[model samples]
Every structure is written in structure tokens, then in C-alpha cells.
Target: MAKNNTRVRWVSIGLTALIIIAGIITAFLQAQADIEAVNTKADAIVKTSEVMKIEGCLPSRANGNNITRIDTRLDSMQREQRTAFKEILRRLPNE
Candidate 1:
């Protein structure tokens, strides 16, 4: 009878330990998922802000000044790109 009691006690202790470990693992995974969700929301907010900035920079029909500024900016960007392409072509080896 004493041997049986000892075996029962050890089995209960093992089951309790297993339950505690499982709870800890579940909590850790939940925390990780929460962190990922927050990061995803942050990324979405950043992307939204970037799109808003671009929209603000673009010209609207009601704003003639913005249209002129955007056209000037586009012209400068095209010139810079053309210059960079010419430089790249100059650097290539003749085949």
C-alpha cells in the first residue's frame, strides 16, 4: 500500500509539471503572436503615411502651383536619370 501511494504521488507531480510547462509554452507563443500583430500594424501605418505623403506631393486640379512644382520636379528627376544612364554606358567595357 505504501509503494502504491508513492507511485501515485510521483505521477501526480509529473502531471503537474507537464501542465505548468505546457501553460508556459502557450503563453510564450501568444506573446510572440501579439508582437507580430503589433509589428504588422506598425508596418501598415508606415506604408499609409508614405502613400499620404506621395499624394500630398501630387498635383490636384484645384492647385495650379502644385502642378507647376510637380512638373519641375519630374523634369529634374528625368535629367538626373538620363545623366546616370549615360555615365553607366560610358563605364561599360567595349565587346
Candidate 2:
């Protein structure tokens, strides 16, 4: 009877160890997947930013200054007006 109890205790301890190991492996895999997903999103955002710059959808830098010195809302309004003026100019017939 004592031998049987010892065998049962050993089996229980082995199962518990395996369970803990499996949990660690699962957590590590999940962390790796999360990191990969974040990297992919960051890459996609960089690509989109590049495309927007190429298409002139992003803000243009000042001729002399290297930084933006105005309010963002005001700058956005100005850009909208500029785009509207360009569209109007394109629709105008040549005299």
C-alpha cells in the first residue's frame, strides 16, 4: 500500500510539472505572435505614410523652416482651402 501511494504521488508531481511547462510554452508563443503582429502593423503604417507623402496628402514642410509652427487645425483648414481653390482653377475655362 505504501509503495502504491508513493507511485501515485510521483505521477501527480510529474503531471503538475508538465502542466506548468505547457503553460510556459503557450505564453511564450502568444508573446511572439503579439510581437509579430505589432511589427506588421508598424510596417503597414510606415508604408501608408510614405504613400500619403508621395500623393501630397500629408502636410508640406515650410521652405526655410524644418518644423511646423502653426496650429494643426488651422493648417488643416488652409490645406482644405488650397485644395478647393485648385479644383476651382481646374474647372475654369480658358479665356
Candidate with the greatest lDDT versus the true structure: 1
Q: Candidate 1: misplaced stretches above 4 Å?
A: 59-95
- Give the C-alpha lDDT of model 1: 0.93
> Per-residue lDDT tens digits of candidate 1, residues 10-43?
9999999999999999999999999999999999
Among all windows of 10 consecutive residues in model 2, the one with the lowest summed lDDT is 57-66
Count of residue pairs whose backbone atoms collide, per candidate: 0, 0
Compose the digit string of candidate 2's lDDT tens values, residues 11-39.
Answer: 99999999999999999999999999999
Candidate 1 clashing pairs, residues 3+ apart or interchain: none
**TM-score of each model, paired residue for residue:** 0.60, 0.59
Candidate 2: which stretches are off by over 4 Å? 57-95
**List of clashing residue pairs for candidate 2:** none
